[model samples]
Target chain A: MSNISLSAIFAETAEPCLATPEMNRATIFFLIVTVVGLSCGVLAFIFGHHTIYNNTREMPWGMLISTYAFWAITSTGLCMYAAMSHVFGGTRMGMISNRMVWMSIICIMGAFATIGVEIASPHRMLLYNIISPNPLSNIWWMGTLYGLAVGCMIIEFAGIVTGLGKLALVMGVFGALAEVLANSCLGGVFATLPARPYWYGAQLPIYFLTSAFLSGAAAAVLFNYLAYRIRNEKMSTTVHLAVKSAGKAMTLVLILYSVATFWRLVSFYVGGPELGRTAADALITGPLALNFWVLEVGIGLIIPIVLIILSRLENMSMLAFAGFLILVGQFVARYDLVVAGQNVPQNLGWDNLPTHFSYVPSFFEFGVIAGSIGVVAFGFLMGERVFGKTFTQKEHH
Target chain B: MNIEDLEKEKNEGIGSLPLQERREFLKMGLALTGVFLGGSILSMTSISHASNQKNADMDIPSEGQYPYPKHYGMIMRQNRCVGCELCVEACKQSNHVPNDHGAWRTAIQEKITRENSTEKREFRPVLCNQCNRPPCVRVCPTKATYKDPETGIVVMDYKKCIGCKTCMAACPYNARYFNEEKYAIDKCNFCIDTRLAEGKKETACAAACPARVRIFGDLKDKSTEIYRLLHTPDSKIWVLRPDTGALPNVFYMNA
Candidate 1:
């Protein structure tokens, strides 16, 4: 609480905070958006989640779950990359590693904000998740590890800002370890259910880990590009090189991710369980077909890969654009995965049950999704404003 | 069929049954409840084309293998179930399930098949399977839904339920529903709280069924009809979604 402690942590007084007009304007805009979007979640809490959310007995999860997955996975990606770069210091990637750490923290917070509201009794979750913990449950592990990762990331960011290199590196490594485990646990949440054959398998956990890298690298490139653009400044050589390295990582991941998707989709047609095949059909030719083919495959995978490869890390703007498309595509991909996996009715031939259950997210669900994005955007701008010097110093390690 | 031949006969699911035997069973089903009994399609390998592989571990526990002294279970005499849905009404009244929420503790699934221009209608009663290895219990992050050690019935501790609805998604039977009244997930607990706790021997649904469709009792009690019926040799006994490996206590039979 004392000014000395605050100064020691932040490495500066409050006067220099919010000094830049462009930074202030952008930060304020996202802050407002965050408040407005989160209010919808608040509305759901006030008037029961059952009243607001379109999730039914058949399809108990909807868009918010997928959004939470997207944000959490993206955070893991950022944390992993940041930790790796910090460990192998003096690389161009390390130049932007500090910012990546901050963004990772922001993205996880966004994930928490979305999931906190999505569950009806978050208070009970907090209480019993500790007192009556179910270690067998993947969700429990996911929650616990992500919570640990966030704490480590906050302390790590503080170390970075205060010029404590040793402290930062140690905490960064621990944070990344927690995040990677949490990411796998998140995948396990869906993958372990034998009842849902579409999600049941060993591949999803690895698939999700792969996605973390792709999204993380894309986020790094996009954020760095925007950082320069916001200040109306051209990228310095180190920063440019940092972004180019991220673009290269993105390119590599995109190819691996494409192969993973192909195998995952193709396996369903060849000797997979009928229920699983039907679920895959929802993505391939049924209700979710357009989302899978267009947004997830076309924009998220193929286009970004093509763009990144053609640019060859030379065109910064093109790389940034590819990153943006990848993020959009990743968002839709998460939604499609979650929805399509549960599309087929568990009781398929009973009482005229439809082959696929329809789940169109309600307006409040969209609001919650937007709010999570706002958290990321606002945090990104705020980090740039408050820790701009620390991020660009280039003297660490 | 002797016990040795039964063992040798591949577990070909419902498809292995002789046409004459299947017809006799359906005829008995129709005579008892005015409808033919249809097998469940919820299995991972659809019941019609169920694999010949035997999963002995996935089957209901045999005599002396029951885990609890009062291992409660249900037998849906599928042949005897009519689409009257008196069980659903009884459950609603006994459990206080909200009608508008589309939640049901127990319901009947109706299937109509045509052969030679003659339509044969069927009904299969369904409730919480209360699996020996319950998916809901495994996935519940807060131990909100758990198996009662003594009764072996999956019960809900509403106080701990966060209403995450993960249990709902994990359940193969589509049993659990978010009860807005309790602000938690709710499902059939075999009427453990409402009926069994009140010194009743059977569930409200079993008591209300005019056709004797649902038979509920302790699997540990060898004298009970449920125990004897399930242990009967050469009988067609099956559980819904066998491939889920949930080891459901709820069994369906033609007896």
Candidate 2:
């Protein structure tokens, strides 16, 4: 067959295509939302500085830190899943991998944006870190590696869209490796802190990687579903297969993650401090109990798992709802990890310290977090609108 | 040849030596010049001393009282503390810290509820413990946080801080705080610049406490009060989170 005929045959087997008008509308809408969201985030930082919730000396890191970790971990998960799909030549995910790659890149950018506002002096941090260069510090590694990973992934995504598939594959592998190391280092930062017994453990890095896979799969399925809805098209067979495969991956990782999270808490109760135990108790029976049990475990894990199973992992709407639940649960999980880790007092036997240190994220912190989500959503939509054709095999006109 | 010509030829031969030998000869010449300079310096010193003999009449301390003992570490006794806010006040004053919403040092009042329905409340002044192997010092990417070799106090140079709060995470003691307005991390420095360096006897908190629950002295010196307390019966010395291996210097007397 001639090259043109072969190309035509390839195009015939591809999925739904977007019209120019639909693409333009989606791009414009996403751009506007992103601008508004980012503006709100910036305003929150400015105005929230004057608020009472700027994290006092008693509680140095509050909501902002947790939110930053959540976005970063989720981004790692997305990138890893995308890279894994490509590496294994998974035919099911081939249609959505391009879009997933874009999502991963945008999510990481969102993570950076949230962290930039969360930090007191980002410019000074960047400058000093580069000039001094401490290889021993986990924060140094996390920041440097993530920056490289994000750069590589963006380049990889660009290459994929521009038909440089070979270059894209190489960049994708590099990006994925960088993210894995960076995410593990992030866990290492917490694990190495012997002071916070709740966080000090060897399992954190592995647990983080597992959750990343879970969340990444959920995010991919949700984004793909959203793209179909926006384009006013039915879910294609290839898309269905992709969602089903991701659903299976999510279920497996979620179970593994749940086990790790359970034992992590149990270990704290068994050998950790009464103060640390009390902090853990807070998760099971204290103020955070509802968030932990109801949102994270119930809605986030159990319900999603059951729904995915009942649907035979084929129902698009059911799976999307599961994805939403998982994302919410993941957010709570991040919050619980950060807040619980610090709630325990250092002076365990002392009678003079406060009963419980209180922390509630200021409005500005929330705004910044919301704005980061907006940035990710905006990026995803814009990428789809511009390169939607590349994300999937082209369908006949 | 005449004697002058012979001397000149000998000097030329010396100059014609290999480079290493010439360098050795140059070094010897420099050494001789240095000796001559030293001799001249000694002579000039004696001459100047003779000319300024009247200034030598200034009082000089006896040999036994000449050099003072060096101060190394500080200690705070729990029993002697009266919960006076003097240390907190003095810290703010000494550091020129802003008065709005941050504190370099704070006093926490913990109310204990006993199992037998008894209630007891105690006030504990809290600041950076100045750990020997400080986690904050280790975690700072910019090395903005450091431990003083002479005083053994962990000090933060605010100008160098980027306010990442990694130090905050690393500190098991929850001692470090970020100054929101200035966007710099702040913690207790044990008043190194004001009290310790000025040859003062004690920290502001120890000196100002009317009940005398605080003691400030060198832990290393055998004669110092801290060493005696550390060795005394029922001393019950404890450093926060010994498991952390920070080797904190801020030893507490009672739980």
Candidate 3:
């Protein structure tokens, strides 16, 4: 026992080695990328605030909202997976809990930044909501819950970094609950709208939660792989277990979500010529058909699911590819959700209604979304660099 | 008329004077006077009551009753509309709505042919219905757009608008427009600022119309030409999208 204790002490003493020059070089490269991203974001905001984006009377909710939903949902997914691993304790993803907590925090921040710009008067919404609470409003609940979840995750990440496992666990549980509620509420924002019948349903919240999990698992595997490649370090045994566990979770969710999506489309066809049917038509036969089939379903789901299965969840490269595919699919999914819901004319059988209404995101909108991503990547890279010691599993001699 | 003397003579003639006769005579005279006075008073009161009811029913011009001039609403007659673009032109001129791309009002020319080889082509001017239950009002996040309670006209306050275009979605009539340059929502205010405020009888389009297809008036007043025309057997009143339950005030003939 004394020999083991002495060896543990020796291991602890030896593990605080300085980050190598290569790690330094990678960090600097990420920093430069982040700066350039931020600079582009600033320029886009300045030039695009008043012009280029043509969100007219015909098209009210534009590309920004879709992009915002994409980021927000992805963050929720990441946070949920991280919390599940930490709280349950028996999960194969136990070792990478520290890194995931950081990723979740950074991703949520990115979500917030994108949404902040998307809303015309976010400050007004915040201030007015506080002064005169509208509990019935889905948006109010969504914004507030997401805000709380993000705050909790940040605290949990800090606690984990400081080696306070118990506090991190408690905060992690809180964060998971908050994220679950917020993600559902985000779906509820659309579901409660009786005006847009396509969005009105009980299925959305569940669909959103499933997507969140799927996206989260994909993100974890992708980011973990990227981190390993950057450091030129082999993933530890524990991280390998985590990747396998996440792959299984991803596969399961992909199947469930695909089923849900299929039924959702089917119901729209069975239903009659209200806005819901029209919205469904917008997906199946209208301008959005290509995106719906190719990006969201073909690339996002089937391809990734096939790749993950064919690889038997063993190969890191296949897992990473699947994760990338899922992310792209998730993006397309959100785009479809936003644009398709609004594409159907409100006045059915109206003579004066526009024959077809369409929208495509301008360069500025793309820049802002890109900038938001840059912010997340920068935050993650910096957090890892400064606090690399805390993220690693403590060596047990 | 010596009633007392006559009574004495009668008493002399008769064995005994009838005690109830004098009382009967007095009662009869009092009853006669009461009946005469009551009948006159009742007739007078009835005449006055009828006159008052007539005044209430009549569409007399009262100050401050309506926010706009006497004829505030626009009416489109089905027969007279020739599918001409005059009203559309007049609306653009009056509102200064961007003629380059978007127009505030338009004329719809629909041609329907029956199986019997009878063709009926209808020309209708479509603009804001100026709905009594405006959906646009319910959806405005900033409360920048509102319906006038007195006039029943949906109006947009461009300065306060955030250019969200929520109003556009809410408006089933497709009346609202977003100014791309100003980033504000715009639509027909029914020429309220110009024609209605000035106490004019007709809008620019109504005046410019050579066929007199459109009629403008207060719907509440029966005496107004539009109201009378709507109620008359010969007049056919129709409202757009009666199924929408909007209770639109803008009445159209053959719509």
* DockQ, all candidates in order: 0.58, 0.30, 0.08
Candidate 3: the clashing residue pairs are none
Return the clash pairs for model 2, or none.
A352-B110, B80-B212, B80-B213, B81-B213
Ordered by DockQ, highest first, the candidates read: 1, 2, 3
Candidate 2, DockQ score (0 to 1): 0.30
Model 1 whole-model lDDT (C-alpha atoms): 0.88
lDDT tens readout by residue for model 3, B17-132: 58698779789999999999989898777575565445333322234444443325666786677877788788778877775334365445454545678766656666777765
lDDT string, candidate 2, B1-255, tens digits: 888877776355455679998789899999999999999998777565443333221111122421224434445566555566776776677655666655566454444556678755566666677776778887787878887766677887776687778888788777777665566888777677788779777776667667666677776566887667655643345555667877666666652
Question: Taking the tens digit of each residue's C-alpha lDDT, what string does model 1 give over A223-283?
Answer: 9898778767788998899999999899999989999999999999998689999999999
Better of 2 and 3 by DockQ: 2
- Model 1, stretches more than 4 Å misplaced? A1-20, B1-58
Question: Model 3, stretches more than 4 Å misplaced?
Answer: A1-50, A86-90, A120-136, A163-178, A194-197, A344-355, A394-397, B1-255
Q: For each candidate, what TM-score against the reference?
A: 0.90, 0.81, 0.70
TM-score of chain B of each: 0.77, 0.65, 0.66
Model 1, B183-241: lDDT tens per residue? 99999998889899999999999999999988999988889989888777656678999
A252-333: candidate 3 lDDT, tens digit per residue: 9889989999998898887543678888877887898899899999999999988998889889989889999999999889
- Residue A113, candidate 3: Cα error in Å is 3.3
Model 3 chain A worst lDDT window (10 residues): A9-18
